[model samples]
Target: MKKSMANGIENDWPPIAASRSARNTINPIRRIVDRMKISPNPAKEMISLSIGDPTHYGNMLPPVEALEAILQAVQLPTSHGYPPSFGTLDARKAVAQFWSRSNYQVKPENVILTSGCSHALELCFDCMADPGDNILLPRPGFSLYVTLCQSLGIETRFYDLIPDENWQVNIDHLESLIDDRTRAVLINNPSNPCGAVYTAAHLRKILLVCERNHLPIIADEIYADMVFPNNEFHFLGILSENVPIVSCGGIAKRFICPGWRLGWIVVHDRHNLFKDTIQPGLIDLSSRILGPSSVTQAALSHILSETPESYFDDILHQIQSNADYFYHSLLNTPGLQPIMPQGAMYMLIRINTKDFKDIENDKDFFTKLICEESISCLPASVFGIDNFFRIVLTTPMDKTEEACQRILEFCQRHIKSVT
Candidate 1:
């Protein structure tokens, strides 16, 4: 068969990838270190106190027994199949059981699994918000929230965490940030960068505010299990009956398996707000994503089902020891003022840039320290604060001590040179 068609002159059309909203306004912090070219890759030997990645000090990696369980799951053909849209039944049940062990009465139906806590946040936002709706987040937070909401065309409003008051959430400022367009408020307890743990009393106040506003609370509790000495970890799910609460958590930081990519977002709305209003949206979103990894889901099942208190006791002991050592190191170091961290792996230090003639800001201090002292640290300016640097206490005990000495020597030399 022969067909005659009118052919038009073809013009070159450019293919564009992603929308304007998807572009990241704030770059990743690691880019600063990536831009440098050092002989023999100095980072191999340098003391890294910048990123909170646990691999720097070997805290997050699991034991051989945990690896065996994961391997066993992979070897089974049944575990290779695509999991349920919400997550595997075994995994969800395990998660529910884990909560029961913690004295919370939760069921498998309440859990929704995702790749990690970050994905859990995305799911929660997608479920709760419409385009142009705002969510309240903490100032100087993880910063990923800004990028995530921006990409989704959702807006984020910040309320300051009062650093002078042990990085507590400023309740008045938080209430002020909420409005008609606000759908939810997010809080990360045992917070990132500053290591702020919200007390039960503080969380109660937050619930009251949310109850009044008729808005849900998104509690990011990935670091829930990492509280240090004298710090109590409060689970919002226990006290979130009146107000709709979406509590996110996972075994990544707690069980040291971030690579496993198993995390969950549980709806704690006993009044059925999330079930009625939010669950449908989350279902639509989760269905399209085809759910989290099947192998990891199975691994999660095993870990959650057999959660040994001994495992956590060991981890808590190690972290407490690490925090203690790092705190003393910072206190002994000259010209650096570090607030003792109650939880998490990082501490922010006030840098006296005025004392160093060549250094003007936190970035400048970080650059020089990396080059001269062979120590890499984060500048707090990136987290909405200036003239201060953040140090990750996740490094090995010996390295922490050594880095503190090196930093002290560098400061002394800089002061002498300036004078």
Candidate 2:
């Protein structure tokens, strides 16, 4: 294929040529996972801590209520046909009611169901920021935040999360990053990669900052209910009055049902700000995708309204037990040290990159470890960090302990001798 010199029509390359936006976007998690193909580790079994999906390890399962609800939904005859563009009235209403707060309650009109939290994020950005505008995010945060922003041609300005301070946002850096073109501030309470939980006070401060800056909050509370026993999960919807907090969440983490692909965006606008502006955009986005699976959509009401608190507590207990085991094991190890995770199913293991002369960065170290030990973890560089890797603790406690053992041995193998 050849391009004309004058008009310069786009190249019609055969079986090739990704668009500029496609070329610019990269899923670092997929990149890291692709290394397993040729890695010279154990063929029969690999202890993979790289995957964030809770179902991979066979430890987590759908609740009886969810499964029964879905089964009942399938027999309803309505589940067979095409679903509503936004979502079922009952489901959307359930989502709104589920996230309602005392001060600023969400209504069904403000909720738009989508495929997953990823889709919710894409939709959120599609409505809020035009191309070339910047949004603030947490550094050492979820890589998807950057990826989702990049594909939309919107810029992502990352503020720091102080690891020493329980991964709380560096407020000064967050404030400094704001500028005229900044449209939104994204918050991932119970952050990915770094299993940090923000306190109510800290989150209120963020809301205050965004409110003062006239920036609406795109709150990613997907892991909202996955906090540890001592930590409480606070919804930004409850905290914000002036700022329009568009909360994106789902049953993926708390209910351990990522495969269902049912998530939603709830506009928690106290003054009808997002309801007027972004709510239509969210609906339009859902219209294009036709919402999440019909059966899953039907189950939303029961899942949100009927699931017992005991089920949630059990899931948290399992995750906390696994996290505690792994964190203690890493701390006891000579070379590996993990920042104790406060929430979510993952945490970061801080590798002394400087001590290991052979390793150039987090990616290099992870690649080598996967090849040598049959243990896999996502490099922290995927989350915009240099010397750490994410350790998913969704596996059973015994398996997590075993993973820690293999990691310690690998660190011992390559760790530089002390002076």
Candidate 3:
């Protein structure tokens, strides 16, 4: 061994490699997005409709109540200290009260706070299934679920969501994927890529499958209560009677504050199925990160309680208005089919590649759009779907109109000639 006199170490040291967890942890969005090496048109200003962050545009912002609460919290002596690993009692209680419905009451003990909804999901996935176990996720779903499951050494099985059916989960397909090693089902309502909201009836159908298979549910309700008029958002936990539910949520979307880094898991096990096992496991896992910021937890109560209903109404109005415009405007764009989102701040448009002259797939459409029109939207391949792209509806009306017009022109330019 060639050793140095000072360190007595081998000159040819073995190569260090990343752990299996780190190596397997791939974000499909980042991976697919990074492959687009082309630049946007310099002549036309770039309008990004890809990012999920509601705060990307200045038109939407957190309410004064939340800001005031945070201001008050930072000044308090108690807010400076570390809270319990899961969360402070007051913070947990506030979450419980906020989520509690007239028929379905949530308890503080069943709540486990984390750094953010992502952290809450990580804890839920970690606690529910061991390595080699499988979890069923939605196809065309938020890619993070696959990233987390892969990183944790858990196998991911996907169920289909029919785009024509307002992006409703194909119930038969969901149940068909379940097998002996399947541990849980992850359902994201007002889903990210699809922007589809599940009705109570539809949610009950999913719960029935879980109940039959004795599988627990990990409800990704981060966009809870964020539905447009004529549509109702149902919590799987509230609708579930027999199936135990671990619901992950936060104020990230509704409050329009993604950077707050505060979220929680609400355990809903009416029959105490998770009381001794999953509940304690989640709490134990939360200890590793020590939960969210102390000041944020301290401010949560005031933020939850004092924020007016009109604030949410205004936000919803803005999102819905954008949705309406995108749906109607893109309808005229040849080779593009825009699915009007029932809820959430996204609109998923299908690219009819066969109807286009040169557009091959979603990635091709995405590349050409940015290079030509300076409009950036996420290709749905990142979300495990093809020939579709997703756009954010949180942009101001003016920007939304501009994006629609640009997209229309781009589609028309590439669309196959009728003659």
Candidate 4:
């Protein structure tokens, strides 16, 4: 110990360290990707398929209506003030109406605006369980779930998703993980790493499990309604008969505006299960951060109502086109199998490690691809999977084609010979 005397007082100081929450909050993607010190090939320009942000390539962007709304909002004298902690009444009403259906009506009173989908999830997790309580998450799921749980001192129990079956949750495995301390089950439809959309029947099966177990659901529907041509997106909140649902969604993915940092939690409590407890807790917790930007909240109503369906149609077409190309192109590649994405903006490719001479795993493939071919993709290990990597489908067609060609060549060069 070191002490210093000043003004007739002795002071002792020790090295400062991060809190347990801060130290345990590890983002696997950043930790893994940043550790790879290999530089991209000098001869070739880098094509990054790693990032989840759609705005990275500039080919996709927020619709004209959204932009105009923001422009109109910024000029307003009333837009500069702080909104209610949960959200402005108008903004919350907009969210409710946007998600409302002919069969089910969403109430504005149940909505809680958040900074982003991530924050929405954080609130859901925080409100549902305390430290040492467990939440059942999907295996090969979004890494943020694990990070947030760990940071909050909540236990994470993973249930497997069947990749061959379009990454559907193993319902049996999911049900088996439930115990006395299990607080909630997190479901990500139109999943990120897998891009698998659940059917109505599949969603019903999951709902049955939760209903039987009396467990509430935390639905990650950030990619809601972003399915491909043949597939349909189903909201778990809509499907659940009795199980209460807290759906976390935002305009980030659907509107291509990640930087906007606006999201909301829609509480679907048909039986009033959450009306007395979790709902109020979420609203109370939101008071700490005071919600998102007032300007953005002012724009949210127009952003939700004025954006044409054709805008979303065009976005889905582009993503499906990219998914089609990657699925077909990589099928011919020697040691990789691309899982056809049903929806969302990513495709997971399984690296047949045994077929490659030098590649050991997904991380090896990821490192070598960037170093030799100047192509970057995320190793699925960060998403709690192995021998697979995920790539974004938001790149321009030209870049997608170039990336496919490079990946083909990279795999061809590394594939083992049968002799």
TM-score of model number 1: 0.90
On residues 46-84, what C-alpha lDDT tens digit does candidate 2 reach at each position?
Answer: 888888899997788878899889889989978877788
Candidate with more favorable, higher lDDT: 1 or 4: 4
Per-model RMSD to reference = 4.7, 4.1, 2.1, 2.1
Give candidate 1 regions above 4 Å deviation.
1-17, 24-44, 57-60, 101-103, 416-419
Which lDDT tens digits does candidate 3 get at residues 1-419? 45565666558656778998899999998898897698999999899999999999899999999999999999999899879999999999999999999998999999999998999999999999999899999989999999999999999999999999999999999999999999999999989988899988889899889999999999999999899999998888888889999999999999999899999999999999998899999988998989999999999999999999999999999999999999999888899899998898898999999999999999999999999999999999999899999999999999999988998888888888999
The global Cα lDDT (0 to 1) of model 3 is 0.93
Q: After superposition, how far is residue 236 of candidate 3 from its true place, in Å?
A: 1.4
Over the stretch 59-142, how does candidate 4's per-residue lDDT look in tens digits?
A: 999999999999999999999988999999999999999999999999999899999999999999999999999999999999
Off-target runs (Cα >4 Å) in candidate 2 are 1-16, 32-38, 101-104
lDDT per residue for candidate 1 within 1-419, as digits (tens), equals: 23334565455556657757656444556455566553323544688887666755675466555677789888888888878778987888888877664556788888888888888888888777888999998876876677677667788898888877878889999999888999899988888878888888988988898889897889988888688867888888887769878888887877777777778987787778777668767766878776778887877766665667777777767666766776677666656677777886677777777667567788877887877888888888667677778887666677877887888877777653622
Q: After best superposition, candidate 2 residue 19: deviation in angstroms?
A: 2.9
Candidate 2: Cα lDDT at 146: 82
The lowest-lDDT stretch of 10 consecutive residues in candidate 4 is 1-10
In order, the Cα lDDT scores of the candidates are 0.77, 0.84, 0.93, 0.95
The CA lDDT at 14 in model 3 is 63
Report how far residue 133 has shifted in candidate 3, in Å: 0.9
Instruction: Report the lDDT of model 1 for residue 226.
Output: 83
Query: TM-score of every model?
Result: 0.90, 0.93, 0.97, 0.97
Model 1 Cα displacement at 194 (Å)?
Answer: 1.2
